[model samples]
Structure formats: C-alpha cells, structure tokens
Target: MISLLLVDDHPVVRDGLRGMYSADPRFEVVGEASNGAEGIAMAVALRPDVIIMDLRMPGSDGVSAIRALAERGIPSRILVLTTYDTDSDVVAAIEAGATGYLLKDSPREELFRATEAAAQGETALAPTVAARLLGRMRRPSGGGLSQREVEVLELIARGSTNREAARRLFISEATVKTHLLHAYTKLGVNDRAAAVATAFSRGYLSHDNNDE
Candidate 1:
C-alpha cells in the first residue's frame, strides 16, 4: 500500500482525506497532522511514502513545512493539495520541494491517482496549475526565472529603469524589458515594483540592498 501522511489545519478536511485514503486498498492513512509544525514532526517520525500537504496552516505554513522537510533530509514525497492555485502558491510550493500540486476541486479519483504518482516520485499537477507551469516554462526565462531575469530584477530593485538596466547589463533595452516581463510572469506580479519586492522577498534579490 502507498503510505500517506495527511497534513491540513482543518480537522474536517483531515477526517475526509483520512476516510478517503483509508477506504482505498492501495493506500493507507499512516498519520495525520493538523498544522505544518505538527506535520513536520509526523513526517519525520512516520516517513510515509507520500505527504498530502495543505498550502496554508495556522503555524509553520505549508511552504515552510515543505522546505523544512526537504532541508532536514526527510525523504517523503510531498503532494500539495489545496484550494489555491495562484501562481505564487503553486510556484512557491513546487520550488519548496513539493513533488506535485493538486487542487481541492480535483475529483476523488484524481486525488487518489495523484497520491499514487507522488509515491512513485512523479509530478502531478491539476489542469489549471499545469497550464500555469507550462506557461512559465514556455517563457524566455523558462520554468523558474532565468539568471538574466534575476539580474534585471536586481537592477530594478536598485531603482534602475529598463534603459539603465540594459546599459549596465550590456544588453538591448528590448531584451531588458523581455527579462522583466518574464520575471513578472514567474514571480506573479503585475508591475516592476511588485516584481522587485517579490524578488527580494523570495531571495531572488538581496534584501541588504535597500536603496531605492
């Protein structure tokens, strides 16, 4: 059976997931955690084949939990199951080491299959989430923000306009704009200021440079 650890803040959700997994002969609910902190502890102790993680929680939070589990060398594959599918949520969770992303709207069978795939260390993305990731992958930056895109954002963080950033980076202004656009898409921001702020918050840019 594919062993699973259910991690969500809501007890009702946990109960529902537990019931679903417990009913399936191919899977088992090995453990349940009500928050990200508890989830991390259970993950370490249980070492379930797959962890069904929620994106938000009261304490450690889902992204923090995923990053922590990966940092602490926990080998359990994490499959994010949440209601939110925004670029920030999906991108952050995947970058934090989740094996897959699935929305709560997904059919019960899809969730079951996603858990199975996650147990096998496969990528499982809901249709919309997959499209978002696919769009990011198709951008000039591709997947995560490219090195050039990050450099552009770093320059912008220092109050450099597109022309100035291009002059500094020795690239054409058009190229600089392209990089910023890609950064906007990848970082899920609408404008240059938001992009720069998000880049800093996500460590794409250094916070030490507070110059505006």
Candidate 2:
C-alpha cells in the first residue's frame, strides 16, 4: 500500500480526501496535519510516500513547507492542493518543490491519480495548472539562463526526452540527470517548465547569450 500524508487546515477537506482515497486498496492515509509546520513534523516522523499539501495555512505556508522538505532531502513527493488558479501560485508551488498541484475542486478520480503518480515521482498537474505553466513560457527572458543549463533547458523545452539529451550531449543519462538536478536546485525550480522559465528569466536562452 502507498502511504500518504494529507495536510490541510480544514478538517472537512482532510476528511473528504481520506474518505475518497481510503476506497482504493493501493492507498492508505498514514496521517493528517492541520498546518504546514505540523505537516512537516508529521511527515518526518511518518515518512509517507506522498504528501497532499495545502498552499495556505496559519503557520509555515505550503511553499515554505515544501522548501523545508526539499532542503531536508525528504524523499516523499508533494502534491499541492490549493484553491488558487493563478499562474504565479502554480509556478511558485512547483518552484518550491511540489510535484503536482490540483485545485480544491478537482475531481475525486483525478486527485487519486495525481497522488499515485506523485508517489512514483511522476508529475501530474491539473489542466489549468498545466496551461498556466505553459503560458509562463511564452514570455521571452532575453538570454538570462546559464550556458550548461541553457543546453539542457532548451532541449527540454523542445520536448526532447532526457534520454535523448544524454545521447546528444555524449554523456550518460545519469550525468544529464545530475546536471538537470543541479539546474533544478540552483534555479529554484522543479520540472522542465520551471527550469525553462528560470533559464529565460535569467536570459540564458537568448541567441546573443553565450557563456562557457
């Protein structure tokens, strides 16, 4: 069974999630938290495979909580559950280390699927969230990204698979992954879109930009 930690300030919200997920034989709710701080503490103690977190809380918001988890090197993946639909919130949550973000009104089945995907380290973003993330990429960054990261980010932005990037770079996929991981950490972003955003925001993708 995949253990899950549900964090939300609302008792009814948690209860609803618990009820829906409990129906699936492959999932079990290991714990619940009323705020980000409590969520972090309980997560360390339980070590659940996934955490369903809320963006807003009384103490230590979800972004801060996610950042804390990433800094601590916690292995559990996060799936953010928030009411906000703005691109900034979606991007910010992802940059803070959330593997996925779903609105509170997400269908029950989608929520379950997202949780499962997150447990396996696969990304699952709501359609709106995906749209917003893609929209952020439309803006030009004016060559603000770094050299090595630019190479990887452009390939990633072109929808090239990581395996393809490894082959093109004449490096092992693991090495490519290492570079991408470092890029992710240093860029304060996760997943390809955020990395691309960071790269463009830093002007690394511009043709006139070159740094070796």
Candidate 3:
C-alpha cells in the first residue's frame, strides 16, 4: 500500500481526502496536517510515500514548504492538490520539486492515479497544467527572447522604421512586423516603443547594440 499524507488548511477537505484513501485497499492515509508548517513536521516524522499538498494556506504556503522539504532532502514525492492553477502557482510548485500538479476539481479516479504515479516518482499533471507547462517549454528559453527578436528590437530602438529595418536586415516589412509582434509578446509589451524599452531594461538589448 502507498503511504499518503494529506496537507490542506481545510478540515473538510482533509477529511474528504483521508476518507477517500482510507477506502482504497492499495493506499494508506498515514496522517493529515492543516498547514504547510505542520505538514513539514509530520512529513519528517511519518516519512510517507506521497504528500498531497495544497498551495495556499494561512502560514508557510505550499511552495515554501516544498522548497524546505527539498532543502532538507526529504525523499517523499510531493503532489500539489490545489484550487489555484494559475501559471505562477503551477510553475512555482513544479520548480520547487513537486512530482505532480493536480487541481482540486480533478476526478477521484484521476487523483488516485496521480497519487499512485507520484509515489513511483513519475510526473502527473492535470490537462490544463500540462498545456501551460508545454507552452512555457516551447517559448524562447532565456527571458523568452529569441535572437531575431533582439535584432528586431535593437533596430527599432535605434530609430529604424519597420520598412527600414526590413531593408537593413534583408527581410520583408511583413517579416519585420512579425518579429516585432513576437518580441512584444515575449517582452510583455503592446507596441514597438514599449517592447524596445522593456527589452533594454531587461538586458535583451543594450546601448552598444543600439549603436550598432
């Protein structure tokens, strides 16, 4: 049987999870905690196979606890079970060494499977969370900026019009526009001026590059 720990701030939620796993023959609900800090202490004491963690709580949020568990070299795999699936929350949990990310609305069978997978040290992600992670992976790696994006922004920052940049770079004006659009998305800006400014502030473009 897979030993499990349910860590959430809500008593009802914890009761529900404990009852669910308690009914399963393949699992054992070893313990429960109301917050991350308590969860960490129990996790150290019980050393369960899987920890189902909730991201937000009144004290010591899940991400911080996950980081702490990792820093202390805890061997149990963590599975985030939370209501929040925003990009920041998902990324932070995964980056902090969570083995799985599942939303609170996940079906019971899905949660069971995820818990099992996490026990075996496998990745289990909800569909939306998986798509978000895939999108992030496909984006440009460093600061989400590509070489072409930097070139386009550099030219625009140096007072080159789209047509002029196209002529100088031997690409079509349409291509210049495309590059600028990509840069704007990566830089989180709406226009050429804002993109250039954001890129320069982020070191994706430099004064020396503008001079060139």
Candidate 4:
C-alpha cells in the first residue's frame, strides 16, 4: 500500500478523502491535518509517501508550508488538490517542490491514481486544464507574449497581484484572470508562483538580471 497523508482545512473534506482512500486497497491514509502547519508536523513525524494537499490554509498556507518542507529536504512527494486558480500560492507550491496538481473536484479514482503515480515520481493534471494551457501555447503571436499569455505571467513572477497585473498589462482584471487560468493550465501548475518556477526551470523566463 502507498502511505499517504490528507491535508485540508475542512473536516468534512478530510473525512471524505479518508473514506475514499479506505476503499482503495492500494492506498493507506496514514495521517491527517487540518492546516498546513499541522500537515508539516504530521509529514515530518510520519514520513508518508505522498501528501494530498489543499492549496489554502489558515496559518502557514499551502505554498509556504511546502517550501518549508522542501528546504528541510524531506523526501515526501506533494500532490496539490485545489480549485483551479492562477496566483502566487500555486506557483509558490510548485516552486517549493510539489510534484503534481489535481483539481479538488477530480473524480476520486483520478485522485487515487494520481497519488499512486506520485509515489512513483510521475506527474498529472486535470485534462481540461492541460488543454486550455496548450491552446494558448499554439497561438500565433510572435512576441513571447503572443503565443503564450505571457505579459501577465511576467507580473505573476514579479509577485504582482491580479489587479496590479491587469493594470500593468492594460487589460481588465477579469481578462487577466482568464489569462492566468490559461497559464496555470499550460504550465501544469496550480498557482502563479509554481507556473513561474516551472517556466524558469524550463528556461521560459530567460532574463539576464536574476535579481528580480
């Protein structure tokens, strides 16, 4: 059985996940946490093979908590289970070392398979999310921003808020949100920080000044 930990703020959600894993003979829900901090603690103490993580939390939040774990070089793999969003948290989580992203509403079977895949060092994302991102990449615009919805992504990497990114890009916030969603899908990351990090690691964000 693949040992796993479930982390989410809602007791109901955690309970549901626990129940789901209980039915899957290949998985064992070894521990649980209601927030990122407790999740980190449980992760350190139990050393689960994979962590099913919600991207938001009260105290430590998902991304920072993941980063803390990574900084400590813990070997546990992280699988993000969150609603679709393109922002700092998702980006930061991926940058911090999460292995995969899955929508919280993904069918329980997919979640289970994803957890199993993660244990073997594989990655997965929701299909619609992946398609949307790929469509943007096939766009005909020549500027890096052309084919890829990059202008807002640049702001994302610089730690800009959605409103700030919209204003800087001369687009409506809703439009910016749309672009962010697409970028998140394409980058195969759940949040802006992770998307940016993936881009950087993949050499998409090439810049001479590393200070920014």
Candidate 5:
C-alpha cells in the first residue's frame, strides 16, 4: 500500500479524503494535517510516500511547505490537491517541487492513480492544468509570455521587487530579473511599468487579478 498524508485546511475535506483512502485497499492514510505547517511536521515524522497538499492555508501555504521539504531533501513526493487552478497557483506549486497537481474535484479513481504516480515520483497533472502547461510550451515566438515570465510579471504587477518575486517563486533574484527582461521583450515594452500595462491591455493579465 502507498502511504499517504492528506494536508488540507478544511476539516471536512481532510475527513472526506481520509475516509476515501481508508476504504481503499491499495492505499493507507498514514496522517492528516489541517494546514501546511502541521503537514510539513507530519511529513517529517511519518515519512509517507506521498503527500496530498492543499495550496492556500491559514498559516504557511502549501508552496512554502513544498519548498521547505525540498530544501530539507525530503523524499516524499508532493501531490497538490486543491480547488485552485490559476496559472500562478499551478506554476508556483510545480516550480516549488510538487510531483503532481490535481484538483479537489477529481474523481476518486483518478486521485488514487495520481497518488500512486506521485509515490513513484511521476508527474500527474489535472487536464486543465496540463493544458495550461502545454499551451505555455507551445506558445509561438514573441507571441506571449512564458509561464515563468507571466509569473514574474504578475508578481511585479502586485508590487513585488525582484528579490521578493525570486523568493516567492523559489528562484534567484537574477533569474527573476531575466524573466522580467524576457517579458519586456515579448510584450514589446522597455520597462517594468510598461510591461505590466501592456500585459494588462493585451489581456495577458486581468484588471482585477493578474493570475486570473
């Protein structure tokens, strides 16, 4: 059986996941954490094969915990299980070393398969999430921003400095700058403000939220 740790802020979600996994003969629900902080602690203590993490939480978020686990060289494969599927959310989680990304609404059988795949250190993305990644890969030359570039631009639009964006994205400040430069080139802008403005104008970013 694949050992699993369920990490979600909602007790109901956690309980439901626990019940589902508990009924499965191929899996074992080794632990459940109400938030990312406790999830990381339990992960360290239990050393489960797979960790099903939620993105947003009360204290530390899932991405932060994922980065912490990677930094500490934890062997558990992180499989994000959340209701969010925004570009920023998906890109950030994957970039932070999550082994897979699945929506909370995924079918039970799909979740089971994804958990098994994650335990084996394989990528398992929800269809919408996979389509987004694939679209980023297939973006034409100079047509649009790459996912990383978009992420950088979104952070900049939110008033994040290079250092802050780098920290949030788990990349170097220099790398963040490079992404900004690439975004500028793609958007045909000469500076940060222009890049953000143009991206918004071109619908690359939403007026309400860059991630949308």
Candidate 6:
C-alpha cells in the first residue's frame, strides 16, 4: 500500500481527503497537517512515501515547505494538491521540488494515480497545468534557438506527427526528436506540445508561414 501525508489548511479538506484514501485499498493516509511547517515536520518524522501538499496556507506556504524538506534531504515525494492552477503556482511548486501538481477537483482515481506516481518519484502534472507551464516559459534571447529547431516546432504546430515531420523535413525521426529537445531547452519547455505552443506564443513560429 502507498503511504501518504496530507497537508492542507482546512479541516474539512483534510477530512475529505482522509476519507478518500481510507476507502482505497491501495493507499493509506499515514498523517495529516494543517500547514506547510507542520507538514514538513510530520513528513520528516513519519517518513511517508508521499506528501500531499497545499500551496496556500496560513504559515509556511507549500512552496517553502517543499524547498525546506528538499534541503533537509527528506525522502518523501511531495505531490501538490490545491485549488490553484495558475502558472506561478505550478512553476513554483515544481521548482521547489514537488513531485507532482494536481488540482483538488481532480477525479478520485486521478488523485490516487498521482499519489502513486509521486511515491515512485515520478513527475505528474494536470493536463491544463502542464499546458500552461509549457506555454508560459520565457523565450530565448540573441538567436538562442536554431533554425532547424524552429522548423521542427513550426511543423509540429501545424499538426504534424514526428514521422510526418521527419518525412517533410527529410530528416531521421531521431533527428526530429533532437531538434525538438533542443527547442524545448531554448523554449524552456518539457514536451513537444509545449514547445509548439511556446514557439507560437513567442513568435518563433507563425501561423501564416509556408516553410515546409
């Protein structure tokens, strides 16, 4: 069973989460906290496999708590659970060492899956959150992105699959991936969809272009 630590400011929220976990045979709510500071203490003491964190709290916000636990070399993976899904919240939680970021309204099964993924030290992000993060990254400066990277991103933005992109570009699929990866680095994104979105948003790729 996956061991869990829930940390939220509201008693009712904690109660609801505890009940959800209690009903699942695959998980157990090992501890609960009302704020980030308490959550950090309990997480370190209990050493649960995963900690369900909240971003906004009365004291020691979730981002700070996540950073503190990471600095102290705690092994518990933190999975953020809250109502906020803004770009700032998602990015801060992730940069502070959160394993996953899921909104509170997520389906019960998704929450369970996110907790499981977090326990295993995997990165999990809500679909909308992921999109926002990818699309919201800052653009590179001084011609940081390569011409090939722009080409690949443009094709991707135009609804081309990797194979199709490769065929159109007359490059190998591996080459396409390499360009995409480079574009991701330059665009500060993690995936192809995000790269394309960022590219368009940053004017690296335009909709009225014909560069195939």
lDDT of each: 0.88, 0.83, 0.89, 0.78, 0.89, 0.87
The sequence of per-residue lDDT tens digits that candidate 4 reaches over residues 37-156 is: 999999999999999989878887888778888988888999988885453444566678888888887997898788888899887766644544454455435423333366677677
Candidate 1 vs candidate 5: the lDDT winner is 5
Off by over 4 Å in 2: 143-212
* Model 3's TM-score against the true structure: 0.70
- What candidate 1 gets wrong by more than 4 Å, as runs, is 142-212
Index of the highest-TM-score prediction? 3
User: How large is the C-alpha RMSD of every model relative to the true structure?
Assistant: 10.2, 14.6, 11.0, 11.6, 9.1, 11.5
Instruction: Kindly list the per-residue Cα lDDT of model 2 for residues 24-117, writing each as its tens digit.
Output: 9989999999999999999999999999999989978898999999999989999999998675688789998999899999988898888889
Model 4 ranges with Cα > 4 A deviation: 87-89, 132-212
lDDT of candidate 6 vs native? Answer: 0.87
Writing each residue's lDDT as its tens digit, candidate 5 over 149-173 gives 8788889999999999999999999
User: What would the TM-scores of all predictions be?
Assistant: 0.67, 0.66, 0.70, 0.64, 0.69, 0.67
Error of 5 at 73 (Å): 0.7
In candidate 6, what are the lDDT values of residues 43-99, reduced to their tens digit?
989999999999999978999999999999999999999899876798889989999
lDDT of 1 at 176: 97
lDDT of 3 by residue, 1-212 (tens): 99999999999999999998999999999999989999999999999999999999988899999999999999999999999877789999999999999999999999999999999999999997886776566555665777787787888888999999999899999999998888877777898888877776665665754685
lDDT (C-alpha) at residue 178 in model 2: 82
lDDT of 5: 0.89
Screening candidate 6 with a backbone cut-off below 3 angstroms (N, C-alpha, C), the clashing residue pairs are none
Candidate 1's displacement at residue 209, Å, is 34
RMSD of candidate 4 to true structure, Å: 11.6
Worst 10 residues of 5 by lDDT: 203-212
lDDT for residue 40 in candidate 4, whole number 0-100: 93
